[model samples]
Target: MEPGAETLYAYANRRRREITEGVNGGSGRIVPVTIAAGTFPFPIDATTRNAIASAATATTLAGGDAYTVPSWLLPTGRFITLDATAIVVVALAISVAFQAVFSAQAAAFAGIADGSVTTHEAVDAILGS
Candidate 1:
């Protein structure tokens, strides 16, 4: 038996409403996708898709904290490479300063115990050292 016109039209309208509601209600939800690093490999029309793809890489897009594209994929205007050497140098400097401070404190305490320096003098030396 054939379906009636009213039943068919109602079914189509219900399906349309279901699709529209699903799209609107799920806004701001995280959807997972994968893309390689360093290339605008995704279609331009879908921003969400591109963002998800870009976030898979360590290098973030320039002008924004959020990774919008792989560093390689971005135009020179759109992205900047992180300074790994600068980071390493700063880390080393911090480590050396910490070591120096601790060594000075230990030496000052030792000197105070050996009677080579007074307690008050040791405290001042530790602070300056």
Candidate 2:
């Protein structure tokens, strides 16, 4: 099994539970689950790919009313549709760096403000801090 398969399975199971339990005011509609197995490399063996696709379709048909997982939960589809994966990754990296930098700055400022160190001393402490 692939790394994402478990997550997908859990997502489907959660949706199944939600549908059966009537989380949305007792709708009582059976939600269908579709699990499409996809290989890592593009253009996989035709037969296997077709079989997986067929299984996914059959699963959808077997369950009366189909309810798909939200876009964010589907890795490939969500990333491709939004085209924001790179942007999000960059943003998160910058955010983490900024937090680290600011935290160090704050620590230096605190030391200076509390009279634990002079401006020059704080600058040296900050460099070493």
Candidate 3:
């Protein structure tokens, strides 16, 4: 039988704490992804997050349809070039993934509070695959 939501909540909470502490199940905070330009190891540290936000805003303000992230911005020393349409698609995908996780986390919390949690469904539902 699958573990209950309470157990899943505990596991998720611990993982979240570990990620905050830069452990992340020994993978650390870097989230590596492959775009058309190349692979980018996106660090989730505060500094990098801030930089990404600033860069995203700058891209919007620059009024350009295309944005080319320089190689230096990537941990793998590769570039990421995306036009506005592609950027939107990528951003939507990311947003959807985050929404799923957050929704699951919230559902777990609510289940814990109300004693309504049942069996586990799938990894993709509770957490992104």
Best by TM-score: 3
For every candidate structure, what is the RMSD over all alpha carbons to the true structure, in angstroms? 28.6, 21.6, 5.3
Which residue pairs clash within candidate 2? Answer: none
- Residue 48 in model 3: lDDT: 52
Between which residue pairs do clashes occur in model 3?
none
Which model is ahead, 1 or 3, in terms of lDDT?
3
After superposition, the stretches of candidate 2 with alpha carbons farther than 4 Å from their true spots are 1-83, 119-121, 124-129
What is candidate 1's CA lDDT for residue 81? 37
Better structure of 1 and 2 per TM-score: 1
Model 1, span 92-128: residue lDDT tens? 4333443444465556555555655454433444535
Span of 10 residues, lowest total lDDT, candidate 3: 120-129
- C-alpha local distance difference test of each model: 0.36, 0.35, 0.52
Q: Which stretches of candidate 3 lie over 4 Å from their true place?
A: 1-12, 17-48, 72-92, 116-129
Q: Tens digit of lDDT per residue, candidate 3, span 1-129?
A: 767666767766654444432463343245555556554566554455555555566668777565644433455655566555445444444444444455666766666567655544432244433
TM-score of each: 0.35, 0.30, 0.51
lDDT by residue (19-113, candidate 2, tens digit) is 33335454222212222332221111223234334434544565623423232222123321111332233223333433444455556556555
Error of 3 at 103 (Å): 1.6
lDDT of 3 at 106: 71
